[model samples]
Target: MRTHFIAIGGAAMHNLALALHEKGYNVTGSDDAIFEPSKSRLQAKGLLPAEMGWFPEKITKDIDAIILGMHAKADNPELLKAQELGLTIYSYPEFLYEQSKNKTRVVIGGSHGKTTITSMILHVMHYHNVEVDYMVGAQLEGFDTMVRLTEDADFIVLEGDEYLSSPTDRRPKFHLYQPNIALISGIAWDHINVFPTYENYVEQFEIFISKITNGGILVYNENDPEVKRIAETAANPIRKIPYHTPEYSVENGTTLLETPEGPMPIEVFGAHNLNNLAGAKWICQNMGIDEADFYEAIATFKGASKRLEKIAESSKNVAYKDFAHSPSKVAATTKAVKEQYPDRTLIACLELHTYSSLNAEFLRQYEGALDNADVAVVFYSPDAVKIKQLEEVTYEQIAKAFNREDLIIYTNPVEFKDYLFNLKPDSNGMALLLMSSGNYGGLNFDEVKKLV
Candidate 1:
């Protein structure tokens, strides 16, 4: 089949292009610009466009389908051409549903820990040599691509994002997947640009729960009142199973599971991750993985990329870079690190990166998020605010919002890095947790790790 992608240079879109290309489909795509990794990977597969930007001439009746990425605008030229041609258009998630309609879909969805939960399930499946089609948001170890689709696989595991499907398709991406088995790790308000209000944001999950196939199973985090309510009030008559953090203890900064088999050392740490593992376990169990087998496989499942990922560590000091920006995420991550190393003096640094985070009104949501840390800092660029076309956010305003008078804020990445580098060696234990969805103004992680 001939498939063309609009805004295909996106991380997920490029992966989809590559997956289709590998599956022997004729894949073509266009993007105004492409970044590294996606660019290189697409180039390696000879799928990179000879020239950048849209060419409506490329659209023709011969193409079987047009896949749209979220990065493109509603009036994108190629999209206009595809609509004009009356070609069958699919959002990435829509295409995924089309491919897996015959298969048992297992979708993992939530504001936080969905990627980790999905990754955990895949890890167990991979460990047992189970061949299942899968899609995850992060670059996981032992997986070549973020997305995989196959003709013969009877099961497909998907990390179902709550983000919009595409510019033209306003529905949440997860809404497209009518999963036979679904899991929600937790819920926190995000994507303020799309949903706008907290109530509107919550209604998306309600819609997702309702979208489950009849008699489907729902594994949810009972700890999250929102998720609990959704699962309880779900209109669909589905088998509802709730999970919370499993019994686990931290030993020397490593999380050890309290299992019937005895205390099992696990590669991943954090209460939120333990909670994620619990949700993943229920999903895997429903998919036919026994409790013993799941426990064995998860022990070696270190972590998903950028979810409290260890950048550098020593006996005295350690550093972690996490994809945490939301108020809930910030608080959860801060507490997780502090709890893991009770003796360590936690120094939490966050970059106000996303649109919601950079908003003046949204700033107040961060109250008490950094209270777990011994030292707290919030970094945001004036240039970034201008680039995102947001009103100016001041350090004083941020401090007031967070309700921390001692909080240090930075407007420059260099000065921020220098401050981090020049920190006096604390006599007591110390842990540095850097959190953001965006890179701290192109700060080199490797150099920062080395500095740590």
Candidate 2:
């Protein structure tokens, strides 16, 4: 089959293109801007566009399907051309559903922990040599691509994001998957530009629960009241399973799981991860993995990239970067690092990058989010606010919202980096948590290492 992608250089889009290409389908794609990794990987596959930007002439009717990435605007010229010919145009999730219709689909969804849970299941599957097709948001250690679609794989694991599908679709991506089995870890209001209110944001998950196939299975975090409510009231007659945080203990800076088999030492730590671990276990168990096999595989799991990734470390100082801009995520990550190293001083820095986090109203949600850290810093770029076309927010506004008068806030990236570099931490009692969905004003990891 012949397939074309519009705005194909996205993390998910490029992976899907590669997946289709590996399956021997004739694939072509175009994007206005293609960044690193995606550009190089596509070039390596000989699948990179001859030139950047769209060409209306490339949208011929002979192409079997056009998969649209969220990166492309609704008025994109190639999209217009495709529509002119009455060719099928599908949002990323819609296309995924078309490909995996015959497979047993397991979709993991929520405001947080979806990526880690999905990665854990994938890791266990890979360890046990369980063959399945999958798509996860974050890059995993062994996985070559985030997406894998094949004819023979009977199961497909999907990280079901609640973000909008495409400019035209105007629906949450997860709603399109219609999973035979599903999981919603929790919900918190996000994407203030698109979903203006908490009620509006939560309605998407409700819709997701309603779309599950009849008699399908749903494994949820029983500890999360929102998830428990959604699972209980699902319109579909789903077989429900509830999971809580597993019994675990941190001893001498290493976290060990108290399992029925015995205490098993693990590379990954923290309460949020442990909660995700429990959910992953239930999902894996439903997919035919025995408890023994699951426990054996989970011991080696390091975690998904950038959830709480340690980028630089020395005896005196260590620093981590996390994709944690949302209020709940920021709070969870901050608390986790503090718990992991109780003896060390935790210095947590967060960036207000995403639409929701930057909003004036949403800033108040962050009250006490970083209270676990001994010293907390918040960074944001006014240039980024301009780029996202959101209203400008003031330092006073942020301070008032967070209700943290002692908080240090920086609008410039260079000054922020310099301040951190000059600190010259050699106390052996300090750890730094730099959290953001965007680069800290493009402050690279190389500069971060000099802190020690």
Candidate 3:
């Protein structure tokens, strides 16, 4: 197969490019700008464009397909050329569906915990030596690429993102999967730029539930009221399985699960993670994995990258970074840290970076999200607002929105860094949680590690 990619420098796009290149297909891609990691990885695999900008010549009649990334606009030069030539164009998710149509597709979707749920399923499958094709959002420890596809694998696990598939493809990415087994972790209104209303944002998930293949299974978190309502109303022929936080206890900062095999200790903690594990367990059971096997495999499952990932730790203090920008995620993450280390002085910092998080109307949903923290800090970049073409939000507006009168808010990255450095490490125990979808204005983890 000969495939061309437009806007191939994206995280998922580059990974897919490399995956196809490894499969011995002729792969070519173009992007205006390529950053580190994606740039180096693509170059190492000989998939990086020789030049930066798109070229009409790159799109040809012989190319079997064009995989379009979300980064590319509808008027992208290569995309226009492909359309002009009448070449087959596939959004990233659409192409993934096309490839795995014959396989038993398992899609994990929700506003939160999608990566963790997908990771757990993948970890268990790997532990049992189950051969499967997969596409997860984060880079796992044992997986070379975030995406994997093979002709022989009978199952495909997909991290079902609810975001728009591409600039031209308005449908949510998860809608195209047509899953035989689907899971919705929870529903929280997000992506304000696309679905402006809360009801509109939620309608996307309803569409996803309706799209499940006939007689398929739907495993969802029953704890989320919105998710419960959706599951109850779903008209599909799928078996509905609802899961909640399993039996677990935390002792001296260690979380242990009460499995049938015995009390199984795990490296990851938090009620949210425990809940994610429950959803994953049901999915694994559907895949023919027993409870004992799931427990054994999950014992070693740490977590997905940047989802409450531990960056640095010492006897005195521990620091974590997470890609949690939404209100529900922020509250859950903050509450988790406090629960895990009850004695610790929890300092939680969140970056209002995403479109929803930055929107004035959406910001009100964050009320009391950081209440569990002993000290709460919110950071936002004025320049980021300009870049996203959003309305400017002041520190007072954020503090008022969060309903935390004493909340410390910063618009400057250096000032925020200074505040973090000044936090005295509590001797008994202290936990620092940094949450954001984007790096807090180039705050280096390496530097933060040393400071913490």
Please tell me which predicted candidate would have the highest lDDT against the true structure: 3
lDDT for each residue of candidate 1 in 210-328, tens digit (9 for 90 to 100): 99999999999999999999889887889999998889888877788888989899988878888998898899999899999999999899899999999998778889999999999
Give me the overall lDDT of model 2. 0.90
- Candidate 2 least-lDDT 10 residues: 421-430
Query: For candidate 2, lDDT tens digit of each residue in 53-111?
Result: 99999899899999999989989999999999999999999999999999999999999
Write down the TM-score for model 3.
Answer: 0.98
Give the lowest summed-lDDT range of ten residues in model 3.
421-430
TM-score of each: 0.98, 0.98, 0.98
Residue ranges of candidate 2 with Cα displaced over 4 Å: 426-428
lDDT (tens digit, per residue) of candidate 3 on 1-452? 99999999999998888888887889998999999899999989878789999899868899999999998988998899999999999999999999999999999999999999999999999989998899999999888999998889999999999999998989999999999999999999888888988999999999999999999999999999999999988987889999999999998889999887667799889999999999999999999999889998999999999999999998878899999989999999999999998888999999999888888888899999999999899999999888988888877789799998789898999998888888887677789999999888989888878855
